[model samples]
Target: MPTITEAYVDSLAPNAGAIKNGRDLIKKNSFPVLNESPDATLLFGECNGSGKEPYRCSVDFVNEASPVFRCSCPSRQFPCKHALGLLYARAMGSPFTPAEVPQDIADKRDKAEKREEKKKDAAESEGNAPAAKRKVNKSALVKKFASQLEGLRLLEKLVLQLVQSGLGSVDKKTVQMIEEQAKQLGNHFIPGVQAKLRAFVHTMQTEGDREAIYSQAMEQLLLMHSLVKKGVSYLEKRMENPELPMETGTSLEEQLGHAWQLAELREYGRAQSGAELLQLSFLSYADAARGEYVDAGWWVDLSDGTVRSTRHLRPFRAARALKEEDTVRAVVRTEELFVYPGEVNARVRWETATQREAGEADYSKVKAAAAASYADVVKQVKNIIKNPLADKTPVMLVAFRSIDKTADGLCLRDAQGKLLPVTDLKTNGSATSALIALLDEKDLRDQAALVMFSHRLDDNRLSVQLMSIVTDSRFIRLLY
Candidate 1:
């Protein structure tokens, strides 16, 4: 049986409130374990709730990285308090005699095992199938690649037109043109790029500072054009030689908007041999123009000094409300993150994660491992400018001596007294202003701090977008 730890149980709780309530119940010794048992892969328990019957809670730990929680409680939160309490008790090493597994839990486990067996059998059978089927599949894939190439061509043409016409003169017709091409790209399995196009169009329609907006729009057009060009070239090469190993880390396909199924990614993470497990800290930003929320955060392999970024998106209503008070950071123990295809600080994705309280981040270690100086950041931005598809590169800057509001914009001064201009200060309403107000109240303008932000290279200039600020006492999230 796998040993359960209190930290692991805390990680399973949905929020701080749940963790507190569960711990309170455990402290009070109110949840008497009515039944308890552990198999090779699961833990089952019945805990007395505030009702006649106890709440039956079962934890499926067959896949240690992605545990499934089932509870009889009516709470909507995943792993409600009852489940947490049960786990907390087990983690505390409460003495309980083993009991026979309940029929319902046994049946569920059996069904899941059978499904796994069937999947294995099917995979083995397919692997042994005739060569004719494999040839047909390869032919189909080639045709699909051809269609994607065509879509890329269409997108490239649209981007060229946008550039020639000028963003300042963009109107409904120009928006329609981009939208049509975006639809085509979507159909070609490039929803990532399609989403970018739609976001560009949305920005064009929305009222904003016309000059700044136009410049940003032009920057986006150039980036999309580069992405399409590279995508087409990649497809052409794949078409020419099918056996060539495709780049795996955040791939061009993902940057072009390919959606990764969480389930599939999780399974891949589990099956990956000799992959390291690392804990990550998560922060989210709302993209109002795209009607989506982007989770932007980092993970560190404490053993190897390997730092990588993890990002995910969710539509407006579908996004979860991140509680400011609760420790919303995810603790990823079982899942291994795979970085996007190309190098230069690629984005990462994982199968799944469990929320946990994040302790104070080790600013010194993270800075030594991942933080870049202002000069290095600018150099990196220049490199990305050479390849426009590498937009919004994640950057961490440490020991920023001061942040001051200038007539032009916000400027962050590094320890060496170099300044970087900050833009896109606000994403969610008034967050930037709120942060400024907090800084004023706390008198932190001259204090040293760590800034977690992204840099966008556009129109031969680098613009820093503020995402979060970490002070000694707290983490201030500027984008939510």
Candidate 2:
């Protein structure tokens, strides 16, 4: 029963296809040979397949934290559909005959135990010394900084030229020219900036309100311009001190596409232990420009009021190869939480986590963390939005005295009568305002909620999008 929950089963799936296929196997009762070891630590089954012989699968829970999934199917995917189906069969209370552990499974477990024991013996032999620090090649890093600087110069000039020409005049020929320039940025050690350039071209090609498209495209250019300036200065500083370790968590580093390792963040003092978190809202979107699917979640750290995010990006090219993240409908207790670099709502990652259904006490913890006043939140938003390199949309939890419809639009008011208008922004296409309008005004009164503060590019005004509302009895999630 260690990994019997639906959530755990969902987590094992490599992609949505596996979940569907696994569920289909259960519904069709494809497993005529469902057997569980007497101790309940091993589960093995034979699932009927297209072939004459059934595909043999087994899930060994010897190490409950990381169950071993072995299948005889030709598929390269880990925990193939058949293996997942075996787990599903147990979770669903489908009859599994009690039997002794199969010889093959027992042999594999013994081998794994021996390998683990050897690793422990080796560590003990060395007196458990810490891992050596990853060596940095000073010369290569200095050259990379130099290349980045050159890329910044080239991009700065390109952005200026595009601005002068204006978005109105952008055409097919211009896009082709831009495409070639974007590819050239790759050679200069600035793939992050290159992605932005490519995103600009993508925006122009998209069909939408011409003004809206132009607005979005112009925003992208503004960010590129900001990155060019900041990147040049940032790299110049690094170029001066090539021996200096890379900055841990900063907007410039994030924009420059630094793939942060957990160990690296720990080295820079960005890692912490005993962090409790509750997911307030979740959303998934396809990033067309980069050809990746982004599964983003907004979580409230129970320890502090600061909000954090976990983004699991699965590239389109490796859709099946990577494990896709699903919405976590429970509270997560992580052993160590690693924070990524950013000014607000910094991306975060964790290695080990224990999840449980969020209870009322957890909700109270989140409610208590909401900002005291709307004015304070507005001030914070203003400072962050002004910086082009900062995350334009920051998810914040606010304590609202009341929700009302002013002549201007739907607004959430604080106790002091300061009102924050709620509207859909170009960056977040989800229309939370429309959803709010359908609900009774009384239901929105006197509540703590998680809202995304966004700067509308079309009109350049600050706006709020409701993500979730925490009431006295229930947590109402408006977005997922």
Candidate 3:
């Protein structure tokens, strides 16, 4: 399923919740206005902004009949606030409308209707509509793969050029050049490679050690080279045996074939610690929903078990009301001491008795305190990166472009200023391909400088400003 982007939410917000109360309810859920339906769907209702202050429970009409509505209020589940809220929100709409309720909800509604119909058609009882199967075209896929290969080649050549020129020190222009290329490549859906490149470019901006940064770029180049080779090999094999059955004969189910294969690849990649990336779902919950997490605490995991970690309290932003469907619930079980990805280092410490007391006693004061803590963390992270790693590991630097109309594996740059050829590889196999497609279609000349932020698990403190490239100086000028 296509994840909802911020733009999608904003577009729906204007219509789905066009009415005041409806809008309020919609905003409280903080979920996106989904066009696709899940099995059970919740409908909108009136925004009853009553009760204990900011926490307003919207009414909702459930799938059940007798009462028709079920709520989250203390009284009864029959006509809950959640159901009412959903119905109210749906009642008043402008350009927006519920594209489709979830299949589950439809099933319930259908069941309700069946109670009135006595005659059941034999054909309807005997037949079933199968789930739709996703299809892929082999030739078209190969062509797309080939295009991405070209993009990879372009990135490699760019990086080599920098390496050859002996301009080890990266300036703003260099950063922009690399970042823009990477961004373009990101269009290909190769988040793994894009992140590698992004990491290098970001490090370069604040790096005190240019040599390490250069080495990092080189390492990434090598990684791309390896990935492309593997991809090409697989593509060739598939072409050779287009109709070959798997040795394991796991193709009993056609619709799930691709998913199973992808899963296999994911497991193998993880085991190898190869170019890997994680899909991050970012969400913010309203303060009113904090009750769910009042007792939760974090369990920090280190990439390498050797790194020491600690958690300290910091203020967090609380929504005035439960955020609308725009908000997402935290998947992690624990509540963050401050923010999910708290700053590694903080400048304005919040350890003071006054700050702690304010945070515990007043919501507004606590938020301010968290912001201050965030500022400190940003400074600390910068400082940490400035000092070369104690082990003096070589850093990887990368740059690349993308393929057109795709967001899967990236077309990686190779040694010959050509993209690593993936003519034989699957084009829409993974997120990497998607990223590659996206990057290939992007324009980097009008590049946007990377923005750095202090990210907690679920929160990002955006402290830096967005910068753009300037040609004459050939250096990235810090934006205010």
lDDT of each: 0.62, 0.84, 0.33
TM-score of each: 0.67, 0.90, 0.31
lDDT of 3 at 244: 38
- lDDT-based ranking: 2, 1, 3
Tens-digit lDDT string for candidate 3 (173-237) = 87788878877875653444455466566556654566655555655455445444543454355
lDDT of 1 by residue, 349-443 (tens): 55554433333454334434534367886776567645566545445444466777779777877767788777653432333533664655343
TM-score of 1: 0.67
- The clash numbers for all candidates, in the given order, read 10, 1, 105
Which pairs, if any, clash in model 1? 192-257, 193-256, 249-339, 249-340, 249-341, 250-339, 250-340, 250-341, 251-341, 266-351
* Per-residue C-alpha lDDT of model 2 across residues 48-128, encoded as one tens digit per residue: 999999999998877654678888889988879999999888879899899999888888888999999999999797667
Off by over 4 Å in 3: 1-136, 159-169, 183-195, 207-222, 236-480
Worst 10 residues of 2 by lDDT: 1-10
Which candidate, 1 or 3, would have the higher TM-score against the true structure?
Answer: 1
Query: Which regions of candidate 1 are displaced past 4 Å?
Result: 1-52, 58-68, 73-81, 84-136, 173-178, 259-281, 285-292, 304-306, 315-332, 351-364, 370-373, 397-424, 427-480
In model 2, the Cα lDDT at residue 354 comes to 64
Q: What is the C-alpha RMSD of each candidate to the true structure, in Å?
A: 6.6, 2.7, 21.7
